[model samples]
Target: MKANQPMVKVISSGKYAPSTLITNEDLERLVDTSDEWIVTRTGIKTRHRAVDETTSDMAYKAAMEAINRVNYDKDKIDLIIMATITGDQMTPATANFVQAKLGLNHEVMSFDINAACTGFVYALETAASLLQTGRFRAALVIGGEQLTKIVDYTDRNTCVLFGDGAGAMILEPSTHERNQAFFFNAARGDTNNTLTVVNHIKMDGKRVYLFAIDAMEQAIRKVLESSGLAIEDIDVIIPHQANERIIQSVSKSMGIPMDKFMLNLSEYGNTSAASIPITIAEYYDQNEVKNKKILLVAFGGGFTWGSAILQL
Candidate 1:
């Protein structure tokens, strides 16, 4: 980051997954895939379903969790950026619904970003940039998805790979230099429609797998280079919970240890944009990450990929 730019600090994070869960066994009855196959391939045992909850509902709950963590002043939050392809509706952005749910009946700048699984990182970078302008105070950055609503249960290829959940982070511009943030978010056009959602989710598994490994590795390297930090300088890495194989591949190719990556996909599957933030929330719950240098990386549909390095 430039010296003239404002710094942003992440105050808190929270995540929410609905009560309904679809296990691998449940999928076995619905499709031809079995428990062992699903587990061995995706490293996902079960994925949560929204049931009656909408995308905005999960987003609101997640934002509330972060707000209540420090009893943050809701009125101070003037910006809300949500990431979700499975929104409640198309007219009003999902972030608007989240703002209403927060009871912030004020002039808040709110919107949504559809960068697929890389949505959270994109939203975070956008929020930080806006905050750096000194135009916004506290901001809510959320990644929520109801992918189950769009997933085709009959298609074994994509049916076992998604879930519904939301994760939120509260950020504010900081004067402390230690609170600086660095990010890289970009995408490659997908003319082939390798991974897409049109009424229902569809994907070419082999193509996506190949793209994911390369995209994630590049993003990680770019962000680390931008920050002039080596992999050892990062206390932990939170990667998009897309597939275990992709992450393992990046780790091996980069020579980074598996333990350095914070992973929880075994329980949540791929929550699209919600994966990274949800894993971050869970990791914070289990570990002391004070003053830690954390790296976040992701790749998704749109052939989008990016990374961020944050001091927390």
Candidate 2:
């Protein structure tokens, strides 16, 4: 007894960052840890630090990139949904600030979704659903995080695992694409225990590792069933870049080669919610996502996880 159109897809994507580099070497200065140790544990060599850059700055940078890539007029966008927990302030949604800084006209709706690390994928699903109704012509899905602000640099366990940056995707209605075919779902494991400060990027590395593989494995299967497609039919997997080991395990268990997946976690650590979007932006910069069956799977705070499958 359901009636509707079909699925949605991403047309163009962009990413941006500050020039400041916060390397593992720098971490040694603020915390009791060495670059070698950090890399050995997290596969992260360096991460960007806004330093003096605000969250709006990163969001703006990303938004401009997507605008250029999509060749979209700011006045033409239908909605702007930023996937982030690190909004620049408590008031106006970071999406609005980003919208203003990007000089986007008010023809679109703008807001933020805070699913921590799962932000980008969740934002995509949200914006896609909005477009499925035929009301939205274009959507700006962005993910930006300034984790360096809340990070206790002295806390080795947490400080070593985050970076700063932003990513944006221009989602437009694909005339040939069917919204009824897109599949999306999110599952929660156990992070309800820390939902209070859910927007603050809380994490237990070991616990996340254990839950990530299992949760991602589950999320992947759910979308596969929903989309009526097989994993082998998917061209590339864009996973939340939280850790090398976790990504590796999921790829292995799914029988998907490492090359079939994207990896930027080695350099960014866990950029909290910004991981997936930033990775997608970087990958597309290299012209990787063309004419492919795309899969986005992510897991994060709230112990939540989900997957999205679309043809691009």
Q: lDDT: which candidate is best? A: 1
Error of 2 at 92 (Å): 0.9
Residues 1-312, candidate 1, lDDT per residue (tens digit)? 455433789899999999899999999999999988988898999899998799999999999998887898989999999999988999699999999999999899999999999999999999998998888888999999999989999999899999999999999998888888888889989999999999899999999999999989889988887777789999999999998988999999989999999889999999999999999889778888789988999999998999999887
Candidate 2, residue 24: the lDDT equals: 86
RMSD vs true structure, all candidates: 1.1, 2.6
TM-score (all chains, Cα) for each model:
0.98, 0.91
lDDT of every model, 2 decimals: 0.92, 0.78
Among these predictions, the greatest TM-score belongs to 1
Tens-digit lDDT track for model 2 on 90-182? 779998998888776657688988887888878887887788778888888888999878777777887888889888888776556443435
Can you list the residue pairs that collide in candidate 1? none
Instruction: Tell me model 1's lDDT, rounded to 2 decimals.
Output: 0.92
lDDT of 2 at 230: 84
